[model samples]
Target chain A: MKTNFRTAVLTVLIGAGTVCSAVAQDATTILQKMDEVMYSQKDMTGKNKIILIDKAGKQEIREATIQQKGTDKRMFRFTAPASQAGIAFLSLPGDVMYMYLPAFGRERRIASSAKNQNFAGTDFSYEDMESVPFSQKYTPKLIKTETDAFVLELTPKVRSDFSKVTVSIHKEHFYPILMEYYDRGGNKVKEAKYTFKKIGNYWNPAEIEMTDLKKGHTTKMQMTDVKYDTGLSDDAFTVRALVQ
Target chain B: MKAKITVLLFSIFVAISGKISAQEENNIKLSGELLTDQRLLLRDNNDWAWNENRLTLKLDKQISSESKFYSEIWLRNIGLPNAVHSSSLYNKGIIDPYNLEIREAYLQINGFLNKKIDLTLGRQQIVWGTADKLNPTDNLNPYDLEDILDFGRKRGSDAINLQYYFNYDFSVQGVFIPFFQPANMPVGIFADLLNPSIAMPQGMVLNNFSDTLMMPKYNLGESSTVGLRFKGFAKGVDFSLSYVWGYDGLPYSSKNMLTPVNMNGETNIQSELSFMRNHIIGVDLATSIGGAGVWAEAAAFIPDQDMVMTTDLSALYPGSPEPVTQDSVLLKKNKPYIKFVIGGDYFFADGSYLNLQYLHGFVHERGSEGLNDYFFLRYEKTFFNEKLKITPIGGGFIVTDWGDINENYAIAYLPEISYKATPNAEITLSAAIFDGKGDHLFASLKDYNMLMLKMKYSF
Candidate 1:
């Protein structure tokens, strides 16, 4: 009778251990699922450009390389018009840093106050160029589920300059599909939409559109050609490259 | 001193009132440049070396949704306002002049008359033009050196304007300028006859070469003008036409001989006699086909019914006993009084574009003198990862038989390079070879080589 009781206790302990291990595996799977979609392509080295048109039909074009590291950070190198070479812009989660020109011999850092100003004397503002980490500032609620992507309605956790920002993330890839920004007055200031395609095991967007609501202007960016793993180094981001 | 104090007190009161009432309406915008030119101005040679370092600040505050106030403050030569000219001067030499002068100050009110009209009464810039250097068709506001020297862009005028926009496609504007500063002409010895301080050799020769002789000196005359402009998309084409009339303080003069002399003989003093009203008519057209865009413009100027002529040669030799008079000689001389331009730009695949332009000046028969013909050609290309872009330009003048540069040609070779060092910064290096007067107008260190560098931040 004693031997039979010990066997039952061992069986129960084994069953509990199996259940805990299964739960841990499930959590790991979920995290990987999110990360795989977010960072499917690491070090996506390529050239891309966008042209924006205003109501007056004036056009401005911007070109850069899309780079990545780990799961959150990405750097862009501006290589067009000798005037804007070696312009380095880095984004890491909620934080962003940008450095540009100060004549030929000097490199001046951009002040935070200048972010709201116009970009290159154009209608687009500096804040309109890149995205702020949505996970840090908002309580994102999954509003709807679609076959290919998910819609998220983000409400700011604190009183801030921007009232609300809506985002769409690809379901299978976890890549960003679209983002809509709302001004302080609850007016839709601008909307950016991304369209992605699969190329050799990598999911990247071939084109993106950013439209301004108040000004009736739109900027379209297209990645015509791309080269991955080009072995670009950190030294390429220096001011010396501006002239080289 | 007492008036200045009173004015200061009033300004303070206004400031306090604005601050107390409109705390949330303050909207300030800052825009300017930190620039240095390689052309340092020279004194006498046709070739000159000129350099400029400047910064400008603009501030605006809305008194209400309907009313707003704005001002533009400038700092020039960075620290040498006094060393440079005062039109928008910065500092003199060792000390920073610390100028708080107003480049533009104005009050604007909108949503008037049931929200159908907009009224702006103050100093404001009104711009309309298509071509770069040749903007003769853009007559909304006259262009001047003060506006050009300051930024190469035209500026605002002290006036009150009203515009009624029936919709996005149609609008009519009436501008009443109580006063306007005309473009400054070079102060020549002949041009300064009225100023007695610069005395020439005693008993300098004087000649009356124009028919009209009695006219006012200052060109800043009071005038009121009303214009009807129609801008709409008709058959997918954009077009506009304008008509204006006002008192022209600087009247055109016909060369007349006070004591008749032959055309070949030596001439003396020239006087500005008589003045007249001016009537202006202008039109503009623009259309796009496929991926290319084209535009054209025409303008005509009719001087006041009674006009006079002014001569510069008179001031040079103040002691000449008898001046020569030739009307046909004066009217058809250095430059044409009327001008026009037609231009177009075409966009190509892979971020490439081509621009073509043509300009012509109409013959002015002020007793019959006309300036030579002027034209330019420009071409630009981008390649090398788009990291390198080059613009090679060449153009010159072809004056008429009697025109100054008659058949005399001058050309310019410009190569502009743009290097994108990173995603956020850019550096532009521009070099060009320009041959011309290289004087006050577009003077460089030489009538030859010019180099410019620009660093931009696109954040």
Candidate 2:
């Protein structure tokens, strides 16, 4: 009819370009299946009750609890009111300890001098409370693959502390949707946006924004009654449950 | 003092008339400033044009919700004319016109319990250290380098303060100066050395307080003060600690004869003393890393309760005759006197931020018998984008550790330039290089070099 419809449209565009080049050449198994579907429905490893809100919208509700036991152990725990209950913020993979209160009852160990302060005076800072160990500090770069997302450009392979991280994953679910922070005069103060919603089989992020380019401030965290793998422990995230 | 100013204006007018019948809200603040200086120091010496003007008026009112009622009034050196006359007897008078009184008035209170306690009782200005020219243990207030070379004026105190906090780190403060008003009083060392016709006599009643300005030529006793402060911060480290106690020294002697018919004029001895007893103690520390930052401090003053004795009121006024004695042990040469500072700051890799410092002062023995042994060096930097700023301040007063004013040496070299223009306007250019030798040539005028230009507008 028209040369058999131009050879069946070039054989369905070469079979959708070999299935998108086999999922972009296995980029670390598509980023570990996007961190197991972004921690498949909670229980992503014990404890968390953070509330950091600042930019003059002042508010710091904390009851920390985190213990992530895979992808390199991490721990943090800070109880409440009675003056920073016990306080503990550790990271094991090249040191980072911040023990707590010791005007007497012992527990002192905060030195590396201010890891970049600002975690209660909020606006993140404390190196933005860990969680970015992207294979020894970034260097990621995938660039593109639209339709569901997957665009990375991390940089910063050694300054020993973030100077670049531009993630944006999704691609059928590996959730990350945004992260920008740069300052060493590289400008770009801060940014963190996420807004996934899928419920079962996970994609988390039901709302999270944290902008602050030189203080114009912004902070929004909405998760309203979430429940994922509810089974936290490890002495409820230690330091004696943040000083009991 | 008028019953401590009517018990501090009746506790701030009954806490602003009981917070206006309990609607609880009150605040009335007003700030003031008016300064001028024009000194073209002899380039061609046309009678050395000198200019100075000052005007300050401040008022603050905020009753209930933790009191506050303040005042600061001044109108000095306006277009000169206080019957001009100054060239030593000690030099300070000339602010005539009935003494235009009242320099500061105070009252303050804060969060009784909830907000973590605080209370201030009138006439205040207490600044503690971070060294900018050796603040020898920063004793409440005391600084008047001829009003910073004719009107860059800055000095404060009139105290009663109490503070306490249990959060935001930690704090504890206390300052009291029941009576210690010393600032341009008795006309700064009695017009620099008496002789207002020998302390008034020909139609006395000099200014208000008439009756010859309430005679009583010289007597500065009955003084009191107390202080305590503590501060804290965790994780990012920060610290401060202080202690002070008041009333030190008491002495007055004035006698003169400056040749009332060839009996010699160089013998007008005057002495008004207060030999230390205003306890003091201090400590400070700061820390930071990851861009670097550090600070340090130290203070001591206990001996005769901390010494700072200065003499030679024309040689000890009131009928002088050999009276500047001591074979040591004038209370063992009163001790204390120790001030120190160490600094650090760095953050340059194209972001600008470099602050280096070093300061020291240690001349116990009454600053080795009247002032000396103080050194300071400061450097500040920031360029372009930060809107240009450069500061190079250096200070001195080694004078071979005093002692007969040991070949006296007083040096100052300030070079500041600022240009903010916007962000509330700013234009500054400071130049100074005052070097006075030998007991600072009886207090300055030996190699003077001063130039200043400042314009600041902020809203």
Candidate 3:
């Protein structure tokens, strides 16, 4: 009777393990679907307006023109703020990046280690501004499931500023609605919320708000004149284009 | 002819602006900044080193989908506290201290003949190299030394630039400058201190001294400058190879004469200074290794001819000398010399930045033997969400001679603190201290230690 009871317990444990594996697989699939929905277009161009708010409620605004091709190439050119005008940032595949300052009249290579640093004094880090899809950088596991969404806990595959990130993805569309970022010490340090709108058969992010809890600062980016599948050539992402 | 060219460029700019204005899809941009910089020396009798207010205006207009016109202008009121001469005030109705400068005015046309070709004409700055401030390969434009503190600043040159792309990762650029422009030197007390003086013999005293500057003529082979560069990127590395045929911005003494005034030991000296022509071949590369950004730039300068300074001492000792004697010194040999800079920068996890560089030569230093080694470092940290930045350690160490560095070294320390009072306004406090024991560049600046305050606003 004791042997039979042990076997039954072993079977139940194995069954639970199988269920966990299935859930993890489901989570990865959902994450990939989210990435697919985010970057469904072949190319995209938009004008972005960023508003930064300090703890004391002071606000500063910046404007930029953003262009993206595929899921790897992206470029940002600042158009507003006289001091920052004509500054450009280009991100290409294999973690290559460059920054151009009009005053210098040349492009400077940005190291991969600078990914964690804030971009242009904004709350968004260089990693956050990257055009790479999340599925390529993080491994996800389903932590919980709600009536309207599935909560996923993601661990980075490579070195990163955040230890882990928790994302709440919509159940129907597989688009992320909110994300909470934790530091290496396992403390929640930042949060990001997204608003998506369907623009001619594509789910486009209309606005995104990122808040740094430790610094008591927030950055809100609003997208306008969004265009998708514009057939942008590869030449547009080159260093020559960046300086121009 | 230069005036005609300038007029033609402006006429083209005006015609393009008119054509673009008639189109409803034209886009025009206007931006600039206002700045006031004040510096004071820290000495027994404290004095103002620099007091100036400047206004900059930039205009950009899109003429077509593949063409654009851009211009920048600066208006400066320098030496605000200096008194105007009564004679000048009497001659002119109002003695305005403000001066206007056209910094850049260029017309850029993309896809000139094909999709891979581009052309830019008029006054512009053609910057090259991969290093930060100490780029040995960036010599197309003459240095702008109006403010010595503003290092790496360059004046715009009137040129025709053409770029052709072989592919997305590689391109070639050619630039032709019709005229040569000399470097602008600093004014005021610094100028007097930096002026070169003649070294006289022990027995002879200098009664009078005179000098003449000999500039190159306005001819294609004499005054014109040309440059070519081939740039490419591969495996996450950007590289460039460039060649420039031009004259050095600084002049060298070419001829000297010493004449005896009387039987006494008093003498008069006359000198002639001229610029040296050279050919520079440069190579530079920039890449990231193990998370840190690294760059290196090197230039090999080959002078066209040997620089010989002839001092005619025949008149100094007329009767006592057995034969007429003329002293000739070889200032610089017609050999190839190199200048290079290697640098790296990293950002720490705690929001600190560190940049370091090893430079083999300064701008004014030419010959291989005359070049001094320098190590530069800058470290800074930001506080209060990046509103305040403090650079506690920033400056360079000059080693005049590597063998005897203990006694032939100079150290300069620059500490700065800047605060962003508002989104568009900033205030900065900085100081430069120098100490040295030998004949390095910084040794001459030991007594010129200064404190500076700057206020800038952008609109």
Q: Estimate each model's TM-score.
A: 0.51, 0.30, 0.94
- Number of the predicted model whose DockQ against the real structure is largest: 3
Model 3, residue B319: distance off in Å is 5.7
Question: What's the fnat for candidate 2, on a 0 to 1 scale?
Answer: 0.00
State the lDDT of candidate 3 residue by residue for A1-244, as single tens digits: 9999999999999999999899988999999999998988999999999999999988889999999999889999998877677899999998889999987878899877777688778888888998788888899999999998999999999988889999999999888899999999999999999999989989998999999999999999999999999899998999889988
Quote model 3's TM-score for chain B. 0.90
Number of the candidate with higher TM-score, 2 or 3: 3
- Clash counts for the predictions, in order: 73, 28, 0
- Candidate 2 per-residue lDDT, tens place, B1-459, comes to 999999998986675455334444567756555545444442345232345455566676655545556777766663333454554324445443222435567665555433466565666556554332334445665433344343212345667667776664576877766555443322322133212223432332223210111122223344666678787766656567888765332221222212111233223223333334545688876555565566677776655332222333332244656554322133333455555667665444333345555655432223324333444555555443334577765344445444555356666666778775543345677766666565443235433465666654422
Residue-by-residue lDDT tens digits, candidate 2, A68-156: 53433346655443234435664433333435442122122233434544454345555555554453456565767678787765677
TM-score of 3: 0.94
Instruction: Give per-residue CA lDDT, model 1, range B1-459, as digits (tens).
Output: 999999987974574455435445655444433434434222355333334444555566666655567777666553232343564444335344333435567776554443546566677654433444455544444343332222224445676667665664466767766643443322211123112222222443333333334534434453443344554435545566766565433334444333324444434434444434456566776655543566676666665443434334433345777663333333322322555677776544333556676766522212223333445555655553344566765433333443344234444455677765543355777765555442212222133355556664433
Ranking of predictions according to TM-score = 3, 1, 2
Model 1 ranges with Cα > 4 A deviation: A1-244, B1-24, B40-48, B62-67, B78-103, B146-152, B185-228, B246-277, B310-338, B362-372, B382-389, B394-406, B418-428, B436-448, B454-459
